[model samples]
Target: MVEESAPDRTTVATVTRNTASTITAKFQADNSEPVENKNTWGYVNVTEVTDALQDTAAHDVCAPFNAPVPNYRAPHRRTIQVKCYEYIWLIKYREQTILKNEACKRHRLNLPKDVNPPSGERYTYQGEFPHMGIIGWKDKEGDYIFMCAGSLISAKFVITAAHCTNLRDPSVEKPTPDIVRFGDRSIVPEAADAEFTVESKIHRIIIHPVPNYRELYRFRLTE
Candidate 1:
């Protein structure tokens, strides 16, 4: 009798621990076999599976289903270093040709051939200015409202007018922005052109402490 090659021990252990219930369920469902232990969790529990999947996903930075690079991962601390890391990572992974070029193009990393963009709304499309973003707040009626326009110069920071963060009328307090949407062009929610818009919540707001025109004028004259 010919003997079959034994499978790797680690692979076997991983498969047994990970997919035993899944395989058992499918097999039992098809073959009409009763679970040996009914009350001992025959099926995979949702929470257990979710937690396990999350743990595994956290380790794989390049996994397709994992969340995109967070704003905190902005390579601004050392621009040259980040650029080099990105370049090496792409080349080592054999993604240097198309994927590398696409990324560089999107971030305006490399020198681009001068092509005059058409003036106005006629020439623009969704995701053209990925840096451009919007700040949104929720009204008392539970409606998500657009508060102001901003630009995403880095991963974590958005640059917007100071007036948007402050109000002169004591009755009008600036509500914390509940939502921040990136790569969206249209003001109307229904008219959003971006299919994969990046979104985040405003955790903190930093406004400059510049004085009003009257105060500035007086201070300038006095100084």
Candidate 2:
């Protein structure tokens, strides 16, 4: 096999400083500067200029701040680009601290659990499923229909799907049926053995701004 020769290096014009004035100056004017300074600045060697050029070229080709000590290779090179608008919100809200230490201390001290006993009944279960219970309802024809599924998130608020009680269409005559079921494995009304009257005073309905309508119906009917 023939021996391969190393790639020939090409000499590229390199600049030690990149000031706009130096870049825009004519080549003749730039070369004349050192010559004019020779008498005033003492004996000027052309080799010194060549050495400076080589030094600048070497610096440009070498890795910055010295190579890694362990000789590991980087998977990729990092490029940094910044946008002013991206940090505008963060800068504007920098001083706003909603959860101050004093407020946090007060909130921890006055936590709801320590204030009162859970208003609704509680149950324990064995298995991987959630321990919370839900209430179911029946239709006029006595067919089992799921009204809502609520968890005792707090003493006053029962967390359930908002679609259960809301109107699908305002023009429709009837709103979605309201039935609450507790301790039931399936949507069958007969399956529910215990029941509780919804305290209208404490009962509330809240619709999420981005509610998944398709999943909402399924959650209300099931868990």
Candidate 3:
């Protein structure tokens, strides 16, 4: 009890320096009394503590696992091609200036300059021509009068008016005309080509059910 153990010589300088500074030594008291200056017992680096606290705050703020990442391509726009034939037709029709002027004036359509109108002169018939013929019955004087217009329907069968056959009384005993003209513009009865002569008698007649008499008259009048 009289002699105290020697203090660590190595820690003596450190203890002396700590005592000389504002820092103090601390030790636990007997009988569990409160220790004096217990907070200063161990060496603490303030810089290291501050650095660890800053790193923990940065990791909490970033929150790396909480949110999903965005797709770079999701917001992009696209274009599509389309074909438009009816729109092209409308554009072409709208651009004709002459047609536009006519519409504005409320006038009937003016024919284009290149088309030639039919001449007023009647086509007189001469004897014995080809392809051209008058479509009518023969009079008592053996002359063909005009009935309705006709074109050659076939070689053997001359297509003419149903009225042409029906107009005359059935009591008249004469056969229908066997002659057909070829290549002649005048309305004349003449011998046809060999094929026409061979096939001429087998004619088929077709009449429209609703004969538009006004249109037929207009066509004949114009001709």
Query: Top lDDT: which candidate number?
Result: 1
Of models 1 and 3, which has the larger lDDT?
A: 1
Better model by TM-score, 1 or 3?
A: 1
Instruction: Give all TM-scores, in the order shown.
Output: 0.37, 0.26, 0.23
Candidate 3 lDDT by residue in tens digits, 1-223: 6998788977898888777543322322222343223344233223333342343333432122122211212111111101122233233333332233333222222445454325774322222234344444456666544344445544443445545544454433343432333443323233222233211222333345666423221102111
Ranking by TM-score: 1, 2, 3
List where candidate 1 sits over 4 angstroms from the true fold.
1-123, 167-174, 211-223
Candidate 1 lDDT by residue in tens digits, 163-197: 55543433322445555787665556654544657
Model 2 is weakest, by summed lDDT over 10 consecutive residues, at 72-81
How many backbone collisions does model 1 have? 0
lDDT of 2 by residue, 1-223 (tens): 9998865443222332344336435543655432222223233233433332343334322122121112112222112111222233233222122122223323434544344323883222212133344533334565545545666554444465556556454433346544444444334333232332222222334556677654332222222
True-structure RMSD, every candidate:
19.8, 24.3, 39.4
In angstroms, the error of model 3 at 86 is: 47
Best by TM-score: 1
Shift of residue 183 alpha carbon in model 1, Å: 1.7
